[model samples]
Target: MTNHWAHPTAIIDEGASIGEGTKVWHFSHISPKTIIGEQCSLGQNVYVASNVTIGNSVKIQNNVSVYEGVILEDFVFCGPSMVFTNVRTPRSAFPRNTSEDYRPTVVKRGASIGANATVVCGVTIGEWAFVAAGAVVNRDVPAYSLVAGVPAKGMGWVCECGSTLTFRDQKSVCHDCDREYERNQDIVRKTKDV
Candidate 1:
């Protein structure tokens, strides 16, 4: 197993499982019981709480705080200063003490949450979904969907290659990869035979 790089200023708590080739940068704190997969990059001042699971090749930018009960699938991109909440309703007097009160947040494989986005608890961002910068996502995002605005709404569909899908008669084609897609009930499906 290859040795992961953790800067001296970084605090990797005991019992945290950091996979090989992962780099924990300056002043980061990885809580105990957090599982970080291989080849991931945690940028400066990142905070990963316990009970968080980060998959391989994930890129977490500076100042991002991934709270407890958040699960990120492989190749997920968390932009700078993005916030993830584990508690649906938080009050100073009424502290959530049990795991049952903490809502789980799931960011599926290859999804990209843009800079400063706020991802509320108990939502699943589907595979390859693109969340625009400064957007607030309060609901479940569909796979390959491009969402923006407050309480984010689906603006359009995106290709797996991260290109916008332009439609012609309910059939959309990816500009970059030339892949074909068919729209069914607002969901885009790959039409090309792989």
Candidate 2:
């Protein structure tokens, strides 16, 4: 018996490893050699390329395509229509189709990517970081930071519970969840979790 659930229209290829309790919704296609963790949700029309690794409890919304070389850690949220690219440059005359030509993009644990956001290849989106809608991310995003706009820039800091954090003396306490964080220059880390 199958532990996970896939819609009748969804296609899970052989050699794809999907954990128990995960759900693949309508018209979604999971390619071979992809590993999707437990309790994850793949929404409608989602396409997962080969060799991609998605951690537990990840939520991938509709119309998102997870290309090769993309690594989504546990609890990551991929908003609807969010884009992930593996190639740096493309031309009709020249094709870079192999895995060696693809650049790796890592979305750390608890990160949330907003709708219509485009994450370019070779970037690391940090843990608990929030990418606002329509942002074009080309660089590494720091942990617990909020980024927005085209070629996304750091707008503010956020708590692990997804609340905006107000830093005073490089430290802040989350008003919503009461989580505590400290910042050293550009780096932010959770000091207390309540």
Top candidate when judged by lDDT against the true structure: 2
Residue ranges of candidate 1 with Cα displaced over 4 Å: none
Candidate 2 ranges beyond 4 A from true positions: none
Q: Model 2 lDDT vs. the true structure?
A: 0.97
Kindly list the per-residue Cα lDDT of model 2 for residues 92-194, writing each as its tens digit: 7999999999999999999999999999999999999999999999999999999999889999999988889999999999999888999998999889988
Model 1 lDDT at residue 34: 96
lDDT at 188, model 2 = 96
Residue pair clashes in candidate 1: none
lDDT of 1 by residue, 14-126 (tens): 99999999999999999999999999999999999998999999999999999988999999999999999999989989999677899999999999999999999999999
Model 1: per-residue Cα lDDT at residue 91: 97
